[model samples]
Structures are given as structure tokens and as C-alpha cells.
Target: MAQNGSAPVWWKDAVIYQIYPRSFADSNGDGIGDLPGIISHMPYLERLGVDALWISPCFQSPQGDAGYDISDYRKIDPLFGTVADYEALIKEAHDHGLRIIADMVPNHTSDQHVWFKEALASEPGSAARERYLFRDGKGKDGCEPPNNWQSVFGGIAWTQEPERKDGKPRQWYLHLFDSCQPDLNWDNPEVRTEFESVLRFWLDRGVDGFRIDVAHGLIKEKGLPPYTERATMVGEDDDKTPSNAPMWDRDGVHEIYRAWHKLLASYPGDRMLVAEAWVKPLSRLARYVRPDEMQQTFNFDYLLCRWNAAKYREIITDSLEAMHEVGAITAWVMSNHDTVRHASRLGLKDAGARPQGIDAAHEQPDEALGLRRARAVIFMTLGLPGSATLYQGEELGLPDHTKLDRKYRQDPAFFRTDGKEIGRDGCRIPLPWKADGPSLGFNETGELWLPQPEQYKNYAVAVEEKDPDSPLALYRSLLAHRKAFSLGLGALEWAPERKDVVEFCNGPVRVILNCGDKEVTLPEGEILVASHAIEKPGFLPANAAVWMTEKAE
Candidate 1:
């Protein structure tokens, strides 16, 4: 029970902060963040007022696709730390009143995983091969891929194996993502049984929940079929139609979740699971949280919405309505490890335009405007009646490091696209902890896996901590007020007085966010806080958000 049993669910109003372990902090000066580094920063997180921390994968991996290509789901990677270190981090996080949610990537496993290696060594049709989606080639001499499906990173989704020991024809395996990461056959009982055990392993270590990676993609249709509609790796086309591909948001996925729900229910501490589902139609997304499945799913629609008041209101309404219909709380997210930083994305001329590759580095963006909108969008997102996620550095208003040198880029998307797509590395740069330290206090080595921009000095935590009006301060203040007002558990009512403004009431608090090009008048009340300075009384500047006490009718 939480919030005196009124909010009952722990995740309903929790502000969960996502930590990309490789970038958050580095202990032992390894030039990469580790669990000890996370442990050391517990105080900082506690002060930030987040209720939980969703750390990205740190499982034993081959450094392929970052840590998502998990080789051993049961063990922590030496790059991060050992299992004992993870347990320590979990205990410390709990001590600080922060719930720890491990990332469970069940959709696929690293090519180097024992299961995958066994599948490759074993002949086709063997039990070892049955654990994954292994198929035979289809064309003359069986050279072509089983189907026309494409990998999310680029190229064919199916990879042909070397000649088998039995001297049989070449076999192909499905890898919806990178070829180094092979998709598992969720239809197999062995696969299901193993993951259920993996869940218990982490749960036994006292994890509060799991953020299931690629949750909608675990189960594919019985017979793999190519997506008739155009498909993108990021699933941008998923909204065009319901269930477009054999591999995405299939009906069978729910059965797996229902089983997962049962396991989580058996555990103590109200353990939960959230889906990183990119499905379309809030209704379809709602199915993942049908009282007996996932507790929440990322609202990608809100993250992709352009800078428009009407668009924001519509998506928020749809998200809230759909979640309410299913008796689940909505989860709002703006920036994450995969997407461009919202601050930088908002500065671009087109908020929804995704620029990629080295050429995109030269694109001129209005950084000031972007930071303003980034600050304002928090009010809109955090003001909504549900849980919200904050990426590591957004509280400091860090923009995407769009100008990273191409040689330093390591995202599979970049290599797969032959450097044509710079990928998500720009947003994954290590966080700046102190303004004056070598490597900006990320590590004493003055080196990082990915180089940090010299400009990061201004956005460093040390710099922002000293400024009362900094984005960090605003975040801390807003979060404190959010708790004080119970904004997360409050009821939402739209108050549309102007087309350029999105206004809503969460309980007794009124939030007004203006996204238009021109400033607009706002209703008078006890002004709580504004994203940008109020240039004139009774008015809100363009791309600004203000929260105030709701006036009596």
C-alpha cells in the first residue's frame, strides 16, 4: 500500500528515473559507469525526489548492442560489477527510499550466449535450435532468407549459419534487432520456463520490479510472415494499422504476460512489470495492462508529439482515457536512452524531425528555445495524472550532444547503416557530475567511452546545484510540490481557454502550458512556479508552463 492506501499501487504516482549505467557515473575510474558509482550517487538521487530508479541492462554481455545483448541473464557483467555489487546497490537504493527496477530483456539474447552458441553448434531441428527462431532458407540452393523481414538495425532480419556438422543445408535464425542478438522462440516452453526462473532470480535479490525490454515482440505469429506495410526499427509505423507484423504486438504476447503477472503476484512487495511496448492506438497499448498483465507501458505517442498544445492535450486525453478504461495508470515519458534528448529535439525547427548521422551534427538548433520547452514539458507531463519517467540528465536540461565525432559512435544502428545514421549515441554520452573535475567528475581518468563535450561544463550537476533557478532546482522544487499536492494521484480536467494553450486541473492545482509562437494571457491565481520567467503578470511566454492554485468557480 502507498499514499495511505488511497494510491495503493506503488507505481501509480511514482516518479521513476531511468539510469543508463554506462553513463550515469564511473567508480574505479574505469571510464564507464558501474554499480558502485550508482551506489555512491544514492544521495544525489534521493535529493532529486524520484520514487524509483530503472537502471538499463548491466547483465553479462559481449558489449554488443551495449548490454541489451545479454549473454547471462543471471549474472552481472564485470564491466558493471558482480552480483554482490548489484545486491549492494539494490539494498542502498532501498535505504534511500528508491525502488530498484532491473531491465529484463527477454525478447532476445546475445549471439555469444550459451543457448545461442549451442543452437549454432547443434544441427537444425535439434532441441538446442528449438529455443530460438531457427528456419531454413527458401530460394534456389536455399540461399535467400526465410522471409523479407528486415532487422531493426538495418539489413535482413534473418542470418544464415555456417554449414552444419551433418552437412545439411544452411539454416537461418531471426534477429529482429542486430545480428549479434538472436530473438528467442517464446512459443517454446523451455524459453518461457527459463525467463520465469530469471525473474525469480532477480526478485529473490529484492528487486521491486522489471522494465521488460521489447515486451511486445517476444511472441511472433505461428508462421513468420513479412510485414506487408513499411516497417521501421523504432516502430514509427506501428500506429498505421493494428498488428502489422508477425513479430510485433501479436495476440499471443498477452498469454506470456498473464503468466508473468501470476509470478509477480506470488512474490512479496507488490512486484510489478512495465512494458517497453511500441504498439499503436492507446487501446492496443492498454491491452498490455489489463488488470492481470503489465503494470504500465511507455506512452511513446506523448514522447513523439510535436510542440503543439492541441496535440499534447489530445495525446494526454487519449492516454489517460485508455489507461483508465483498463483500470491501469498511464506512464508518461519524454526522453530515454534510445530517443534524442527532448531539450535538443525541441530546439529543432521541427520538433518531431529526427536528424541522423554525421551530417546531422552540423544542423543548427535553437538551444535556448529547446531548453525552455524542455522545462515546460515537464509541467505538462508530470502534471498529468499518472507516473512519469525522467532520463538521467534532463533535470539539468542537457541537450543531445549532436556533434560527437563519427569515429566514437558505437551504436549498432550507426554501424549497420554504414554511419549513415549516427544513432542514439548522442544522447547516451556520460553525465557531467562536477563542472571542474577531470572528465567532469564522471571519472578521474579524464577519459570516457564516449567523449563529453566541453560545453557540458555549464550543465554539470555541480554548476546546477549552486544555482537556485537552474533546471535541477526547478525539478527538485516541482517534484516536492507534486508530492505536497498529490498531483500524481489527482483527477485531471481539461481547461481550454485558448487554442495555443493547454490548461488542466490536477486536483486543486491548475497547470497551464503554452506552446504557441506567441505569448498568451493566463488566468490569475497564486502563482506557484513557471518554467520560464514571467515577463508580464497575467501572461505566459511562448513555450512556458506555469502551475498555480486552482481558482474557485
Candidate 2:
């Protein structure tokens, strides 16, 4: 963003708000969020001070793994709305100065997708079957899966392809996620052509950008080697070092993006792509945003850091330095559809590594403590020298609904793990718009796809709108300051004389975060914002952050 010679791209300083469409807002009382619902909320987002909106997948899907298992790349899911409805949302969003970035899930398609269906109908060696990874099972009757790789959702990655019309033994097809979501073979030219067409279809409709889901997982190693190491939900295997895992972050992935970059360049309006790659070490993550690849990649390293000041500074420095090498801006994220809400996670004494889901309804978090830390972290995330994303409900300081009844959970991981993991249902609960309603104003009907926790009423937009110190208020204030101070566009340098604290300056603004247990003396300046009330005017308490401007010389 600080680079010269050409005008900076809008995304460099943009504050992107991620909306999980299933829970954002529902129109037509269908108990599901739709494009019309997002359109109605554009003014709300504009008021919130975000520059762009990245809507989670709304493509035609079978509702397995939510909308990630897209059935038709060109059509809007009937549950969300019609194509006309999506076009209207894009037009309205742009009119309000809010760019729309649609989610593109190119890693795989729903088993119900036309190609996959045809693959099932055809024999193992057919051209349709070649679009996906199909291999003969390695056993006497060829019943064993091709490999021992594990699925992200807690089962073996390979699923037996349905029997052919002749009723011979079936072959196995690779599915890195749920069985309903079959991995597409990037080696196939047809697969690449189809996705390029999908990109153009939305770009032609005025969409400004795309948030690529599983961007690093799109390509696999040619041999499909056995996966002997355990994998974290998102990143490289347990050791924090890159491994030769046949399914993730393969070198072949870069070629796919290089081609995609060319396609995006062909379109006007500076259309862009942000990769949701979870590869480790800032160096590997930086590969996603190389000059010929995506414009930005999500900084999961920062998101996964424990609540320690040293780690915070370390990751920030590492991330920025990595992006600097690639001449790309880093993107920061707090929470999203797939993870636990950071608000509640911050409350845990140990916090541990990010668990994909809570194990029990009884593992309640301390709401007050979590909200304080969450509030402080926002200043740190937004003040950094790059783009930032706000997950829906995070601005409301919404904690994960840990008490959701097991019967109501829909995330496939829950069922796959057989109750050992609760899945992402906690963070995916429908948002509370108004203070009171049968479904807390998420829909006109009393029903919702995922039930809202009763406690959400207190954190509803209406209530926060009236509270000066609410998370919503803090977010709006910080976003306003972020733009006014040119924080995201500025260079970052660590400030001196801060002990047990992460202190930095972004251009004219000095940001200080106290992650230690003791109070830290605040540097003298005009106070811009503080995460918590200053018990002593010149001192900041533990688990807080402050933004200040140096006084005139």
C-alpha cells in the first residue's frame, strides 16, 4: 500500500466485513439469509464504516457443509435468492460505496454438482470421472481406500465412488472435506476452464473481488502420497513446519493462482482475489500473494497467536515483513464461519491452540473478561499496516453460543466426530438485529436455520447503538480513526520504552496494547481511543489498548 509509481489499490486500506450469509439476516421469512437480506443491510454496513463486504458462498448448493459444496458455480442458490436478487445486491452495495467480494470455493464442488453426478454415472476411466480424483482401491477386491489420508472433517479422505451401471466393484474418489464435497482435479484443463468462466461470470455482474476458500488446497501432489502426519484444522501438520502432505499447500498450487491472476487482470475495476490459505510460517503464507498470484492472503498466524504481547509483536513483524518481500498487503482476520469466536476464546486461562470446536455445552467462558480482551485486540488488529476483516457479530462482542443443543448443530464435522467436536455451530448462530423478536429480528418467522441464543438479545444492534461503550460503538470509532489516521496505509515501527507490552506507531498514531498483568504507564499524548476506562489517567491497566497522537512540538 505504501508503494509508489502507481495509485494504490482500494483493498490496501479497505476494512472488509465478512458476512456468513446463513446467519447475516433473513428476508422472506425463509429462516435463511439471502441476497435481498444483504441488500437491506448495506446501509447498516455503510454506517458501520466498512469499505467492502465479502459474502460467504451463496452459489447453488445442497446444504452439505453449508454452501461451500457449491452445485452450480453460475447460479445463486435458490435458498438464498435468484440471480436477479444477487445482481441487485451488487448494484446496491456499489451505490453505497461498499464493494462486494463473493466467496469462490474452487477446491471442490458438491457431489450433487452436475460434473460429479456425471462422474458417478460414468465408469471409473470416463472423462467425467477424470475431472475428479478417482483411483482403484488397493485390496484383494479393491475395497480399501487408495490412501490413509484423513479428511478435514474427521474421517478418511477417500470415499467409495458409487457403483457403475454394470454393477462392478466401485472405485474411490478423493474428498479432502466432507464426502459430499469431492475434490476437483486441478490437473484437468476442463476444471481450470470452468472456474475461470465462473470468475468472469461474477466479474461481469460487477462484483469487485473474490475471497478464495481453501485456496492452497486446490492442487494436490501428483502421486497422492499417503498422509502419515496429523493436520490441524487449517494449517500445516502439527510441527509448525511444512511437510510433504499430498493434500495441502503443494507447490503446484502457485501455477493455478498465476493463471487466475491473469484472468482477474483482464477485468476492469481492479478486481482482486484474497486467498484463505492457512500455510504456516510467514514465508510460506507469503507465496499466495506473490507478484503473479493473489493480491492478499489472510494472516492466520496473527489470528492463531496466543494472548501474549511478545507473540503479538512477533507475528505482526513476521507477517508484515513477509508481505513486504512479496510487495503485497497482509490481511488480518479475527473470527469467521469456521472458527470459535475470539471473544469467548480470549477468556480461557490457557486458550490453548485454536480448537476447531468446543467439546461441550458446559465449557462456558467468562463473558466480561473475554469482552475486555476482545475489545483490546480490535485496536491491535485494525491499527496494523494492512487490510482487516470483521466477522459478523464480532462488532457486537458476541461470544460463541456454547450452549447450543446438540440436536440443532448442523456443521458436518459435528456428526463426523460423533459429538467429540461441537463443530462451528456456536459461531454460526443467526445474529440478533433488534433487541426483541421471536428470532431476535434475524427473520420475520420465529424459526431460524440455527437457533439464536437468548443471551444475544443483550448484544443486539439496537442495544449497542444506544450504548456509548459497546463493542459496536468501539468498532465504529476505531474504523473512523483508522481512516483519519491513515493507519492501514502507513508503515509500522515498534515504539521504544514499553515493557511487557506491544507498542507500535503507525504514521502519526501510537498504539499500545498491555497484554501483561500489571499496569503500564501511558505515553503522553492526546488520547485517540482506549479499549477500557483508564483507572488512572496516565496509566493503562492489564488487557487493554490505547491509541494516542503525539502532542505538537
lDDT score at residue 431, model 2, on the 0-100 scale: 92
420 Cα displacement, candidate 2 (Å): 1.4
Q: Which stretches of candidate 1 lie over 4 Å from their true place?
A: 1-7, 228-242, 356-362, 550-553
What lDDT does candidate 2 reach at residue 360? Answer: 54
| lDDT tens readout by residue for model 1, 149-224 | 8777877888999777787789899998899999999989999999999999999999999999998898888888
Q: Any residue pairs clashing in model 1, and if so which?
A: 357-422
Which residue pairs collide in model 2, if any?
Answer: none
- Stretches > 4 Å off in candidate 2: 1-6, 235-242, 359-362
lDDT of all the models against the reference?
0.88, 0.86
* Best candidate (score: lDDT): 1
**Given candidate 2, what's the lDDT at residue 267?**
78
RMSD of 2: 1.9
